[model samples]
Target chain A: MLKRVHFPASLLPYLLVAPQVFITLVFFIWPASQAVYQSLLVQDAFGLSTEFVWFENFEYLWGNQQYRDTFGRTIFFSVAVAFLSMSFALILAGFADRVIRGSTVYRTLLIWPYAVAPVLAGALWLFMFNPTLGIIPFILDAFGRDWNHYLNGGEAMFLVIIAAAWKQVAYNFLFYLAAMQSIPRSIIEAAAIDGAGPVRRFVTVIFPLISPTTFFLLVVNAVYAFFETFGIIHAVTQGGPANATTTLVYKVYNDGFIGLDLGGSAAQSVILMILVIAMTVVQFRFIEKRVQY
Target chain B: MVEKRPGFTIVAHIVLIFGVALVALPVWITFVGASHDGARMLQAPIPMWPGDQFFENLRQTFFGRGLDGSRTAPVWMMMFNSLVMAMMIAVGKIAISLLSAFAIVYFKFPFRMGFFWLIFITLMLPVEVRILPTFEVVADLGMLNSYWGLTVPLIASATATFMFRQVFLTIPDEMLESARIDGAGPMRFFWDILLPLSRTNIAALFVILFIYGWNQYLWPLLITTDPDMMTIVVSIKQMLEASEQTPQWNIIMMTALLAMVPPIFVVIAMQKLFVKGLTETDK
Candidate 1:
């Protein structure tokens, strides 16, 4: 990784890396190890006694109906989010890639949501979907349909997914557009000359060619929906309507902080950490494979 | 330019326009919501067009107590807190990452790879997963309700460091040798040569990280229990929770606008750099 002509081994490099190393140890490594350790020890509700029970927390999570439901719900949430946002972005990117003129303007208009914080995005969506006074509900009322994310569990999941997916569309779109643009024009030109229509070419040529970007975005978006959308879940529903929207990450925060259930929360945290590690490994492995393409 | 298919081009434009409009609709509604008076906002079928109370809402949100019942720090104070937190995080991450990446690429340090892998571990352990213990550590250190608590724990960024490392690796080794030939120390070369060369990258990364820092939700929410120390982003949660009774749509929408505006401005104004930064860091 280093240059051939590197500086000799010295104390200066130690000083240079000290800050990052220190922070990593203190904030990241320590907390992570503590989570693992805490997961093994269950404390009484009164915070009176602690006992080391090996894998009991994990077993408890596996057996608990709500935790299991949250796990399934999280996978469903990520899949739905990844599918919705990616397809939408891919469609927009597919179209945007065709327009020779005003593509930059289109991109500028489309990607500003990337800068919006997820909580605020949640707030905005919550505002729009507010049952009594929201504009969307008003529109839905005219259509003879009800829309309120608050009291309905399915609707709560749907709303959070939309907000989470909404913010992610910009990121996916940028990547998809970049990936689309990087394809050599001659291939598309030859396909067009061979009488492949735009849809046909996109399906047969562009889509497969950009599978690497698609995969990358999939992993990125899944990790995003898993961890980063905590704000959206927290602000929008608080894992509400009886924990219908409780992702694993949100459950960790809720159990630990709000519910004050340390063992359960730490166990959930450890599970989420394992999931992250797996996702990171998968990302790196796929990234290595993508380099071959 | 693949082929001049007029029908397809028309269709493409329509799709893009529709997509843009869909993406822009929420912000447009929020903007409209922020413009009307409180009573108007409370009414059903809130006006789709902007009303004339924009400055009045802005005045109330910015200068006065933010909402009716919530005793929050003034909107400007929270925005300033967000600004300070964002700047610190961006600057802090860039500074330390530049140092560590420089050391890893330029110096033959012992455990160089060890340090690199150690930093990489942080990527897998996000604050959400380790919230309780991290919060306990911060509380044990008495950093809660402080700027350091808000910014520092979250600043150990593996992505930024890796990006800089990649940037440094692309630089010719001859630059380093030539600087050594001139008898300049490593820090001097870093300050005078490397910093200037990577200025654009630094700026690009700044745009991305600034948004990241500004948009932090859970950490700031957990750490800054004191309302005075709350970030604008975190304050939205507070406003939403507190306003469960007699919700003030106008003021809350205004605050959401306040929270999103600066970062949105950065992304749009620095669109090129933002794109560059995003592609590089994530890769």
Candidate 2:
């Protein structure tokens, strides 16, 4: 990746990379190694000493019903969030791609929510669903279906999913729209000439063509709902209503910081690290494929 | 667009309009909710239009005492903390990324790829995944409750460095050669040539990183237990906690509004650069 006529080796280059390397070492690399090493070390009952018990925390977590439920719940939450946000964004981008007029205006209006922090999104959604004074419950009462996320686990999960998905729609929409814009106009025109309807053309041509973006957004959204939705889960649910909304990231925080189960928390952290590494590998592989063409 | 179908165009327009409305609805609700007084918000039939108590709520949020029992920082002070944290994170990330990218692209050195891979690995290790150890590290360093504590650990950006490396590689090699023939030093060449060329990239990355830094929640939430160190975003959670004791919807919504406005304004104002930075950095 380096240039051909680059400068010769010197201490200046070493000095230049020193700051980033030092920060990365102190913050990322060191902490990650700690998570891995500590994952294998179990503390004694007195909370004074630790024993090097490899993989016991992970095995205990695997056998624990609550941890297994949290793992399943996190998968469900991430998939629901990814599906909802991506589909909504795709529909909007498909429509926006059709209109020549004021598309930029629509993009501007649609994408500002991306700037709203996840926690703030949770706050806004929580206010509107505040049960006693909330507008959503008021409307649901008119429909004869009760809505109280505070007591209902399913409803709490639903609330976190909606808030998390709503924040992600703008990001997904921008990518889908950009992918759509980059597609050649003549391909669509050719499909129209072949007697294909608009929806059929999109199904057969446009959607397949943008599968790269779809796949990329899939990994990105999964990474987001896995880790970044910590804010949403923290603010709105606190992984509450009987722990229905505790994703892996939230669990890592809850167990590590609040629970003080060091080995268990570190095991969870190592698991999450493996997850991130897997996702990153998939992403880089996809990028490599894209670069080849 | 392929055919002159006005019906299809109208439907597209309708769908886009509805999508836009759906996206904007929560924000509009927040705005309306913020404008009303606390009692008005707690009652039924929250007003559809803006309320007359906007300035009152703003004043109360900025200068009022604690809401009933719980202590909270003044809204202005929390936002200022957020501002300071955000600026430091954005500038720090760009500065470190630029120097590292310049070195990687323009120089041949020992352990170059080793250092590059090390920086690149930070992308996979988000603070959420390793919260305990990182917090322990920060606490051990006695950096808790400070701006350095808030921003420093979050500043090692793999994406920014990668993006800048890509940018520098695209620049002609002749520039460096000519600068060298003119007796320009490495730092001088970097300062005079590379910085000017990558100005837009730096600005674009600033927009993105500023938002990234501003929106941080879990990091600041755990580290800054002190009231004075609370950021605006984190303060929303505290305000919500206080709402259990005293339901001040007006002030809470106003603070949420205040917490979110600056980043939203940056995105809107720098829409082009934001789009460019986002697509490039993610790629």
- DockQ scores for all predicted structures: 0.88, 0.86
Q: Identify the runs in model 1 with alpha carbons over 4 angstroms from their true place.
A: A291-293
Error of 1 at B235 (Å): 0.9
Predicted complex 1: CAPRI docking category: high
Worst 10 residues of 1 chain B by lDDT: B63-72
Error of 1 at B188 (Å): 1.1
- Total clashing residue pairs per candidate? 0, 0
Model 1 TM-score on chain A: 0.98
Off by over 4 Å in 2: A291-293
Q: Each model's TM-score, in the order given?
A: 0.99, 0.98
Please report, as a value between 0 and 1, the fraction of native contacts recovered by candidate 2: 0.86
TM-score of chain B as predicted in candidate 2: 0.98
Clashes of 1: 0
